[model samples]
Each structure stands twice: as structure tokens, then as C-alpha cells.
Target: MESPNNKRKRVKPILRCSTNEQSERSPDDQLAIIKAMADARDWEVLDPIRLEGRSGSLHATMDWAVEQVIAANRAGEDIDDAIVYDQSRMGRTGGFAFGTHKQQLAAAGIGFISVDCPIEGPHADFIQFANAEAARAQAISIAASSARSSQISLERGLRGHSTQAPYGLDRLYLNAQGEELFIIRKLADGTSLRLDPRTGAELERYPKGVRAYRKGGLETATLCIGSEEHRQVVIRIYRLRHEHGWRGVRIARELNDAGIPSPRGRHWTKDTVDGILMNEVYLGFAYARRYTDAIYFRHQDKAPERLEGPGGRKVRGYRPREDWFRVEYPKLTEYLPSKLRDAAARWQAAYWDRYEDGHVRSPERGQKRLHALSGILIEETTGQPMSATQSGTRANPKTYYLLPGSHQYSSQESFLRRRIPSAPLYRAIIDEIEMLVCDDDGLRDILRTEILKAEAERRAGDGEAESLRARYEKLGRKMESQIDLLGEDDDDVMRRKVEQTKAQRRAVMERLAEIDQGPRLTADQTDELVEQLIEALQSELAAFAAAGRPAFRKLTEMLIASAVADLRSGTVSIEFAVPASMIQHRFMGMDRPCEPKWRTHTHKWKSLPLAAITVELPERCDMDCWEPFEPKGCDDCRRQRRTA
Candidate 1:
């Protein structure tokens, strides 16, 4: 014990880890190991350091000690040596067990010693390697067990939560007051309440003694003049967009024009309108989870990055709506009327299905050429017309042709195939028209006849009837003005206006009839005759359907067929027709319809030789009953009959 020259050497601070072992050793094991330190005397004075472990178990103690040793080494400390009560105290096997303890000691420039093996260093190769392997295996086992526990919790809908709270809901936990802060509850007065720590308020209790207090809804409630009124407005908006065929932007504009106030009392923008339309709360249900959260790991920022979920790996980052939590928030949106709610639900479903199946297209991105051609095609057989399937609304695009399984055309594929290769038929019609119109004078005559017959009439002895004539003429002017306002080529609007004008004209004619005298050439009689003549002329002009005048049904059929064929083969052809007005304006050679004229001799007896007929009778055909093309059922057959 010694040479005076070996004067007391300075002792380094040391750290140690102790873990569970099969064998039980007491303080003697620790005390003996401590004695192996470089400055043995200092071991007597060094206080025992303890670290908190998982439990009060020995394994936990060792886990803590390992952490301490690793930390000390990182801080550049140089403890001379670490003492372990036994091999298992540090780890399981000799190699891995001692290997871990020795690695820690070596990292801190300290040597390791076991009480029973005083001559050995913790840094010895065998011990260091063994300890490392054992410690790694323990860590892996713990991880696997933790994962299994998490999986079980998920299956049970329990959560590890990691102290994380869902949005609009607080993480429930016992605080200093030992009270459940997030549990739903009914107070003594039977009011629902939730603990809001930020405001230091016990909000209205919920049924489950747990609830996430909603700030927006609460604020809306406070500001809402009447919840029913606000809910009615929301219902109206939803119905108009989802049920009534109004777009979100148009709905917003309509609401603003009607002086309706939005929930925020600001001008409604398209985005705001879209938000309202897309909101599920109005149906008395809504998923509290947001797409932003599902896609992005966090949602603190206004714009967050999209996160690809484990499930999203197969199909990009979209999560099915069914998978989202459908929380029933009883009050937030309960005010919506049942009928409106049902309608909105149906519309949303249809639109969602369309979106999912790639049936919807966007105009902003510019539609494909085929889509544009499809829009112009109308189905001749059915009254319905085709829309461009490739562009426009993302939810309900204008489709060129109806789907194959559609009730309107169950055999759509066959119908399209039969129609697509009708180029020869179309060419024949074109050839016939081209040859028929070869003589310009004959063509002009046809046009003149149609135009003149469409004009109104007048007769002699109608002098006293001028007042009624003027009234009729005034009505005609109004009708023309309305037609002009409606513009051209917009069938829906034009058809509506035409119906309205016809009703008004019918009333006028009825009034005229009531004032008419017997067929004695009286002033009233003459005016009545003139009006009847004009009406007859209109009927006759429509009946003399020329070969070049397009058959409305055939045109429609061709358009629909062309679109469907394009969809199958991915080929498209476009034809542009300049509007008559544009053509007239751009070129001065065309003749405009003459201003309405009122005359006696000029109107009644003048024949302008306006048309000529060179009928091509199909050889050996029965002129009395023969018809072209297969009957597309009754309505089309009736139209052909009337025109013939």
C-alpha cells in the first residue's frame, strides 16, 4: 500500500449503472467495486448518485445509470472507473452485458470493474462488445413491445395521444386541481360544460362529460341575430347551389344582390361561397378532421404541405370521405330544414361520385379538342343534347355524349358506332345540296319565298281596322325586340321567350277575334282576314321544308354520334359557322330582311317568284308513304311527316 512517491493521486468523478440480475447482491457488492477505483480513499467519500428509473426496479436503475454514463462521456468527463454490482446488473450476457458498461466507461475515459472481478477493466474487449449487444437487444425488444401496445390501443380506439390534442378539442388530463379538464359534464343546473384553461371558464357541459369547446360556433351564436334566420339563409344557399343548378359564384352574387348578409357580413367571394357549399355541417353532421391535417403532419400554418399517409401510398394523398370521423355536433348545423338537407346530400353524393370517377373536367386548364366538338353534337333520336365531357366544372362537366349505361340510350356504344362512320351519308347530303344550289338565281328564289311568306299580311277595306293592325304591329315589334335581346343560338333562352311571346300573341288574337264581324268585307272583317292570312302563310312557309334546310333531328343525331366516336377513337373534327350577323357585318353583299311593310295590292296579289322546286323523286319509291332513314320512334317520325 505504498510508496511515499505515489502520493495521493487526484480521483475522477464517476457514474455507474445497476440493473436487474438473476442473482441478488447487496451493498457489499457495490462497496467492494468502489474500492477498485484509482484513488480508493476517494471512493469512501464519493456520495452514491441515483437516477430515476422506469419503476423502483433494478433494471430501471441500470437503465438510468447507462444514460448517465453516456451523458458524462459526451461532456468530456474522465472518470477513472465505473463499478457494477454484478454482470447482469449491467446487462444479460458477458459479452453484451459487460460490453455496454465498458463502452460507457471508455467513452468517458473511465475504466469499468465488477465487484467480483476486481482485476478486469470495463473496457476489456469481450465485456464491451457483450454489453453493447445486450443493451441493443433490450432496446429493440422494448420498441417492439411498445409498438404492439400502440396497435392494440388503436384497435380499441384508445390512443397513446403523446399528449397531443385534436383540433377543436382539448387533450383531457388531470391537472393540479385533480379535475378532469376535458371530460364532458352536466353541472348541478344540468348545463353542459367544458373546462377552458385559457379563459379560466367552465364552458357549457356536454353529455359525455367531455367536449371540445368551439370558438367559431360560440362566436357565431353570440353574433347571430337569430339562429333560425342564419340557418335559413345557409339552407337557401345550399339548395340553390346543390339542388337548383346555381354555381357557387352565381349564388354568392344572387345573395349579395338580394341584400342578404353572409355570416361574416362581408361581400361573399367565390371561395366563401364554395366553403359554404362544401360544408357538411349544414346537414347536421361534419367530420371535425380536416384535409389539411390529413395531408400535412401539422396544421398551424395557413398553407401546409400535404402529407402522404401510410394508406395514401397506393393512390397519392387522398383519403376516402368514409374514413373520416363523422362527429355529430348537435347544435352547430341542426337548423337546416330536412328537405333541403336531403337535397344537398344527394347533390353532394352525385358530384363526389363524378369527381372520383374522372368524369368531371376543368375549363381553366383548356379542354381537349374532342370535348369542344362533343359539346356541339346533339342527339337527334332523343330530345336531349350532348355537352362537352372534357371541360368546364370539375364536378359536373359538359359531356359530349351520354354514358353507355344511361337510361336515355342504353345501347350508346352501338348507337355511336353506327353513327360514327356515316361520313358517306353526310357527303351525299352535301353533294345534293351543292348541286341543287348551283344556280344562284334558284337559290335566291328559295330564300325570297321563305322570307316573304314569313312576313305579315294586310287587305283592302282595312282602313278602319288600322288601330287593331297598329296594335298587332306593336306586338310584333316587341316580340322582335325580345328575340334580339335573347341573342342567337341559345336554344333554352330563345325557346322560353318564344313560348312567352306565343301566349301573349294568342291573347291578342283572341281579342281580335271577339271584335270581328261576319264575312261581309266590314273593316273588322278585313283586318281579321288579313291576320288569318298572315297566320296561314307562316304555317305554309314552315311546311315547304327545303332539301338544304337542316333536319333538326338528323343534325342532333350526327353531333352525338360524332362525339361518342371521338371518345372511342380519340379523333376529333371541328366546324366553325360564322354567325349571320357577323357575316353580314363583315361583307356587304348579303341582303337583310326587309323592314315590315303594310300595303294592299303589294301585300295581297304580288307574287315575287321567291322560290322554285326541283324535287328529286327517288326512283321506284312510293311517293305517298316512303320515308328516309329508320324511324327514331314517333316524335321524329311526326316531325318528318309534318315537314313533308
Candidate 2:
């Protein structure tokens, strides 16, 4: 036997949600529960329901939903009431605010009805006050939970634990041999274990020979200098932001235009560039809690209601820097000096152009060397690195490459002696690079052969994972279908069915998650990618023979680790990062000294490529002195004295 009713009360369903409340059941589901109750009570649910956004108080969306009931009645749609799944969805802002909205709805004769929120009948006023308190309690709980998680993550950063290595830094070498590194697995007794790559047996002690486990490179990670091919892009990004005073968006655009790959293998964006700029990890100081509140885009028209103010596109609440936990790595510190890094940060923050900009055109004109040799040139006199700067106004700029020095170097080289016309020197070095690439095929051969092969081997393992992903997608569709077939009833049989479907879905999801940890590229895919690269390089080689900057900056960074003008020797030392052990000293044998003619009348100087300079040969390649020269890096302690 079933009870029947003739009159169906026309009602509108309303739901409000905060952007952070992802764990809450969806609005549609909540509406379905409301609809089920409505149907039982012989109520007619209207079209065009309202679902709004909130963290706590969102006045506009709720205001629009309330007005809609009045408008519908005026238009002869005769909306009798506005129903909410829960009364708390009405407002947790304040009891007064909640009561005011309730009064307005009552005055409109569109009685406010809450379906599952059980305080709608007798003692409704008491229940309403209690509901408001509960809503406040819920918001406090969510905020408290969020703060706790953030504190934990921030604390981990302070303890020198990182989810990822900083931009322009990776590969924690095992020892001075620089045989890469790995996750140091420790037993319960605190014994560090490294499984032998060949034997799979646990070593009693940390092995000196082991490297990180990779599909192809079980022996080593990619060796990098500050100008390492892929890594140099990051170096370029840092320079663009700090040294040149370019905004993150501009930097990202430049990188995108140059076809440089982002960390996640996509086009760069301002947000990503901003992350790198703010990332303390680059300075070898770990910091967290910069991003606590996540961002979401609120679509226009699709937005629940008109926003109250000038915002809705992006929402983020930042924690103060003092509240952040930071850890400093004394040994791992590299790249920019602390003084320069700090100054750059302050300058960027102080900049008005960074805030309200289409763009402030680069101070210098022409295709500037925002890559490779931007920070590579060193002055022999004061042991200083050349920096990029512009002398003339933005409209007609005269870019100068200045060799600014440390306190000691500053005392040595007078201010007037540091500035040099950048264009001629930059053009000359680029010409020299073109000459080297035109004549020698050492780097090209490596990229086309060994590098491509390594890439292929690494990617070969992704086929199974791809197949698993396909299976997972199909499995998801089947689960959705099974769910759709189930009735909306909450009886024990339906509940059991729901539980079974959930368990099945979870098992499949667990397997999918497991596969996510595996590789996503195949060797076949890599081979195709490599073939495309080879074609591009071959086509571009002939064009590079003409006098111009090379298309690929990574290749330039690879061939020339650094360029130094040795004024005393009348030679510019261009150190090449050739992989050959015997070739290091042999390149000096082909030395030919020549004076470089300068466009400026201020100084008379001679320069020659380092490849063309003569030096006393080392007996063999010493891994100890293999790293690129740093101001106070390992090269200083090398017992081998340079005989020029």
C-alpha cells in the first residue's frame, strides 16, 4: 500500500560549497537526495538549480538563488519554495545573516525548505541556532586540519627533506668519483643498505662504485655544469628573472618561444616561473608552506552568481614567510651567491613593472644572449665573472657586459675598466662557436648516437604501463555503468551493492595508482623522437655554418663550458666539455694565438679561443678535477699547477 498526493509543490534546489571541500559529496548527489525526499512528499523539483562556491561566506551566489524564487513567481513559473539539502548550506557566516535570508524568503511567500536538515518543523528556531553553531564548528575543524598538514610539510622542509631537488640541481653523487646517488635505504637497526645492481644482494657497507638505479643509466645520472644542456635552461630562466629584471611571465614566454622544455615537459607559464624564482631550494636552502591554499578558476556565466568584488578567476591565501620552516644545506649550496640572490629577490619584489605589466621591453635590443654565456665569461685580472647590463635608455640601448667582482676583485679592477661593449664580444664568441660546430662533429656524434640510444633504452619499458593505463580507463567506465544501474534506495541490499562496487573500484584504482609509479614512455616512442631530432639537427647544420647564433643553446652550453679572456696571455680560454679523456690535453696542441680586434677605443686587447691556447698537458683525466670551474670549487685544491 502506498500513499498518494494530488498537489505537487514547485520547488528549487540550492547548494553551496567551498572550493576546498572536495571530500564532501557532490552537489548533484546532494540534490538527488533532496529530490528523492521531494518526490516522496509530492513536491515538484524545478529546473536550473543553484550551486555556489565558498570557504565560509559567499553572499552573492546565495543572494542570486533567493532572488530567483521571486523572479520565477513573477514570470508565472510559480516557484512555491526554495529547498536546500542541508540548512547549514544556507550560511555559517553569522546567525544574523542566516536569519535575515530566512526572513526574506518567508516574506516572498517562497518558504525556505531543507530536505535532510531535520530542524524544519516544531522547535525550528532552536534547531536553526544549533545548526549555525555546528556550521561554525565545521569550518574551524577544516581550517585546523589544513593548518596542521601545512605545519607538518613545512617542518619536513626545515629538516632538509625535499619532495624534489631544486631547479638547476639534482644527482647527489655518492662520492668524489661522482658515481651518481640513490635513495639510501635503512634497516630497522639503522644500517644503510645499497642493493648490488648486478647481484641484488644487500651490501654490508655503502659501496663507493654504486650509482642511481635507472633503466639505462644504472651506472650514473646526467653529468651537469651550471651550463649543462637541459639544466642550462633553468640557469637561463634564473638569469632572466634576476640579472635582467625580467618578469616571470616574460621569462616564461621567452622560454616557450625558444622551444625550451619545462620540468614537466610542457610549455612554461608565469606561475611555474614564479615558483622557480621563489623556490629557496635553488639556493640550497629548503623552504615550504609558500603554497597552502590551492587555486581554482571560476568560469563566467557558469559562476553561481555575480561576485561581490573584483575577483573570482584565481583564489589563494598565502602564509607569512616568517611562519615558514626553512632548512639550509651547507654543502649543497651552489649557483648564485647569497648576497646576489637576496638582492635580486628584494629588487623583484620592489619592481612595479612585475606587478602591473603587459611588459617592460628588455633594456637591450636584438636577440640577447639570455642563454649559455650570459654568466660564463670570467675576467682574468680580478677573477670576476662578467654580468649583463644596459648603459643607454630602453629606446636606444647600448648593452654592456661588465665584469663586476667581489669585495677583493672590486678593490683590484677599477670601475671604468669593467664595462665593455657587449655586442662585438658576444658576436665574436658566437662566430667561434659556429666555427667549432662546423669543423668538429664530436658533440653532434654523441647526441645522435650514445644519447639517443640511452633515451631509447629508458623509454622502452613504458609499453606495459601504457597498456595498463588503457585497461584502467576501461575499468573506470565499467564501474561507472555498474553504479548507474543501482537504484537510489538506501536499503541494506542497495548498501551492500554499493559497498561491493566501491571495493571493486578501489582495487582497480589501487592497481592504476601502482602503475602510475612506473615509466610512461617506450623505446619505440623514443626512437621516433630521436629520429625527429636527428633530422632537425641535420637540416639546421648548414644554416649554422653561416655567421649567426646557434638555434640550440644546449649544444652551445655543451661545447663551451665557459669562455675566459686572459688579457695577459692575449687569449680567450674557451674550455670545451668533451667526454674524451685523452682529448683534454691534446686540444691545446692545436693552439694558435691571435689578437681579437675590439670595436671600442677604450682598451687594446687580444683574444684567442681556449681551444687555440697552448698549455702543459696533464698525464691523464683526473675525475677529481673534472667538474666545471667554480670560484672556490674543487679545482682550487687540485695539486696540478697550470703551466701556461
Candidate 3:
């Protein structure tokens, strides 16, 4: 047997842990592990080496630890292995120390052991691989839960776990005697609470009930923006959407480029920026959901496309806006009040109307199908542009006609010229165009100069490019500042900063290309542009034909024919299927059509009577077949009824 001293020198067995612990945690917890090692008289505890002279300096501690491990190897001690408390305290950085220092130590026959981990042995060459993986998983879990809880709390208007209070607010804390602290009346709406302003005490509790500013006081704070930190957030949100005129995507990109910290001090996303833009709380009100679970709630992800049923049709309903709870918090504008919002709302409303009007999502229900010429047709009476009206149907389908009341005899004249069958007239117009214009020279001219000019002007006036350029400049400055602050030795930091700057500059340059102040086209450019428009219309016709949707094809053909007819000549006229004046349920048992007695007829007594044709024009009559009809009476008679 060996002597007593030799027996005392024997190394204790390294602890092995199972995969599961308390509540899915491993059985070998941190405290349990430390006690077990102490009880077994382990060879060494291997406490993280602290720099002798320097404290709280990570670099110094790491250098000292590296030196200590190297020295122990040279000392000729029977150092079979080293043990550490856990992955985090073992090395300052994630895997740098373990993969570098630990690997070198193990090469000299020493092994590294983590008491609370199951990973071990010679095969575990990269001990950091295991430690880093565990650390990463822990971080992700913490982040996900924290994000979920924050979302729930915000939605419910509840106070979250935070340290600071807004400006004008004071946090009350316990005194040395553990008694309720004194109240400080600095609380402001829309502000976060931090340390007590008057007493300089740290806030360690929730329900630190806030107090409003004294009415009509000079120092009365408006917002709950407790600190300068939160004030910056409010300013940034306004700068992005209002000052810069940035859309949601641009706002996110700008924030990311500037390296501005989000509410949680992380990178910003489109959703985060959108949330800020939509949030009214910053406008001086706190509107949050009333109740929510205290824990994380994960909504199920939407199913993949292949797994969706029946083309993923959505149900429709009206959700009253008033029913949604809203509490005004301190804020600026409720939302960016601009033409962009109005335009977006109009588009959404129009889209919904198209779908709901005919109980189908098709061009037949869309205004673009029939009203492509809506803005061009002027009422002789009102001198205003005509507006299209949709008359829904069950037996025949949906029909579109111009609104009435602009011309004379609108209240009494039965203005039903054509209905869904008017599509045939549209088709006939296209056929006539094919016969008249051979090379599309005239059509191209109109498209290139006339219509495209208007569209280009509208696009140029839009502030999108200007906003992006401003955002790019802002981001560039921020990135340059960050780069300058980085140490010369930090190659990774410099490279990343340089790359980000290059990308942002490139985006800004692209936006500059779209900024056009000059005339969109020269006289020579009109023909080509008009030709392109015709070609696009032809493509639409082909698409409808291929899909076997006749109504859509007719609609496209009609719009092109009407536009061409209007521009080629000076006048544009459209005959509708059913006039608004004629819209009424039939009287019971009525047989013959009868004009109401109040309706009056007006016509010039031309010596020659107009000839009525025997063969009715194929609701698809070619444009060549119809001649321009001039009204000899009042201008009101010349204009088609608003209900025609």
C-alpha cells in the first residue's frame, strides 16, 4: 500500500452529469457540483486567475490566466487535469480561451473539466465547442422569452421590468429601516422611471404609482419621457417618418445604418420601426391591452403555402375602430399625417370595393377595367371629369356606367345604352383600331410623350428618393464615427464598418438616379412611348384570352380603343348598357316599356332626318362604324348623363 501522504495526493474522479436536471435542467447544478468536488477532495479547483495588480480589467485577467496555465505546465507538477465552475467564468470571451489556452494545456497531457456539463474526454478536443453551444442556446432562450414578455406587457399597457422612470418622475425606494419611502412628485405621462430625481434613490419595485404634474405649473413636464435617453427615441421616430418622409422599409434601413439602439438596445427591424410609427403612446397617451399572461406566449406560425387550403381565401368583416381601447399618452403626431397615408387608405378601400362589389376578385369588378378613360371624359354642363359607377347584378353579373346629373334630362332619360354586353362594343373598337393604325406610330407618340409625361411628373414630385438620400447621409456619418472610435488592432470592426458604408452609399446613389426634374420626354419620344402603352394593352388582352376570361379581355380592349379615339380626335364618348335614371324595380304586371310623362325631349329641327340602320351594330361594332354625333342644342345635352 502507498503511504498516507501519497494516498492524500490521489486525484478525485471528475463528476459526470446526466442530460436532465431539475425541471428539465441537469441534475448536476452549479452549487451541487462545487460541494461534490470539495467533498471528494478534487486535485484542484482551478479558480479563474485574477491579475495581481489589475482588477475589473478583462484583458489583464485573460493575460494573467494564460500565463498561469503556461507556468503550471512547466512546474513539473502532476497536473493531470484542471476544473472550472462553468462555461461563462472559465473564459472572458465565448470560445477564444478554451480553444487556445485550454487546447494548449491539454496538449501537455492536462485535461479540462466542467463540473456541471456532460461533455468530456480526449475526443472532446474543442471543449469550447460544447461550452459555446450551451451558452448560445441559453442566450437565445433568454432573448426569445424576454421579447415575448415585452410584447405582451406593451400590448396590455402594463409596466414591464425596467429600471428607469421618465423625466419629472421620482422612484421611491426603502430606507435603511426598510420602511416605505417618501413620495417624489416628478412623474410625467409617457415617461419611464429610473432613479428618484429629488432623493437620488434607485427604483427597485413596480407599481411605483406615478403622479401628474401640478396643473398650470411652470415646471410641469408633458411626457413620461423620463430621461434624455427616451427623448432621443421620440426624436428619431419623427425624423425618420416626418422629417425624412421615409416609408417603413426605409425607416428600418436608416435606423440600422445609424447603429441607433432600439428600445431593447439591439438592431432595428422593419416590424420594430413600423411599431414605433404606429404606436400612439409617444403622442402623449398610453394605449395598451388591458390583460395578458405574465409569461411568454408564442403564436403558431402560419402554415406553408403548399399546406394552405383553397388558395388561402380570407374571411372579411368590419371591425369597429372605436371598440379598440386607446389611452392617450404623451406624444407628438398620432401617425405621420401625410399624403402617403391618404393614398394608401384610398388604395386599400378601392381594392376592397373591387372584391366586394361583384363577390369576385376579377378585373370585371375593378374600376381600372372600365374607367381607364374616366379622368379624360368632361361633362359639358359641370365641366368636371366623369366618375364611373358600379351597378352589381345577379342574373347577368356586374355592370359599370358613368354617374349622371352632369348633363340635361338625367333625372328622366332612360340612359341604358349597353351593359356587360358593352364589352362587345369595346372589342369592336379594337378591331377598328387594327384596321386604321398600321405601325402604331400615332399610338407610340401619345404614350411616349403625353401620358408618360403626366406619370413621370407625378413620380418626380414624390419625396421617396429625397428621403432616402437624406437617410443615407445620416447613416454614413454615424458609421464613420463608429469606425474612427474603433482601435487600430480591430481589423474586423473596421472591415464591417467600411462594408456597411459602401452599401449605404451605393443605395443613395441609386435613389439619386431616380430624382428627375427635367422634362420626361422630347417631342420625338412620344411615338415610342405610345407604342409601348399599346403593347402593354395587347399583353393584357393576351393574358385574358389565355385565361379564357372574356370580360377582362373586352375591358382592356375597350379602354385602349377609347383612349386612342379620344386623343386621335378631340372628343371621347361612351354609351352605357343601363343608365342610372333607369335603375328601378319593374312595376308588378307591367308589360310594355313606358316613358314617365315628366320626361321631356329636346332636338333640333334639322331639315334631314337621321337614318336608323337595319342591322344593330354588334355590341362589338368597330370604331370605323360609329361617327362623331354633335349635339346642336345646349352644352348640357352634349354631355352624357352622369348616370349614362
* Predictions in order: lDDT: 0.39, 0.48, 0.39
Q: Rank the candidates by TM-score, best first.
A: 2, 1, 3
**Sliding window of 10 residues with minimal summed lDDT for model 1:** 216-225
What are the per-residue Cα lDDT tens digits for candidate 3 across 1-644? 01121212212122222111121222234435655764575333333333222211132344445546544533333344555556544543335534665666555445655655637556665666766545544544553565555444434434322223332223333344434333332332232334554555655322322222212211222233334555566456656666567766566556656666555455555666666555444444433322221111221112111112121122122223332334444233333244534433444445334423222122122222444344344433335445455543565343333424222222232231122223333344434333222234433443344344444533445677678768878888887887786777887878788878766765565445434433333444444434444554445444543554344434432343122112112234443211111111111112223433211111001111111111123333334433322211111322223212
lDDT of 3 at 501: 78
- Candidate that scores best on lDDT: 2
Angstrom error at residue 179, model 1: 18
User: On TM-score, who's better, 2 or 3?
Assistant: 2
TM-score of 1: 0.23
lDDT of 2 by residue, 86-192 (tens): 87777554455567677877654467777766455578877787776677567545545544543443443322334334445543324335444443332222233
Question: Total clashes, candidate 3?
Answer: 52
Q: Tens-digit lDDT track for model 1 on 8-56?
A: 2222223233222211333434544555653344332133344211221
Local distance difference test, candidate 2: 0.48
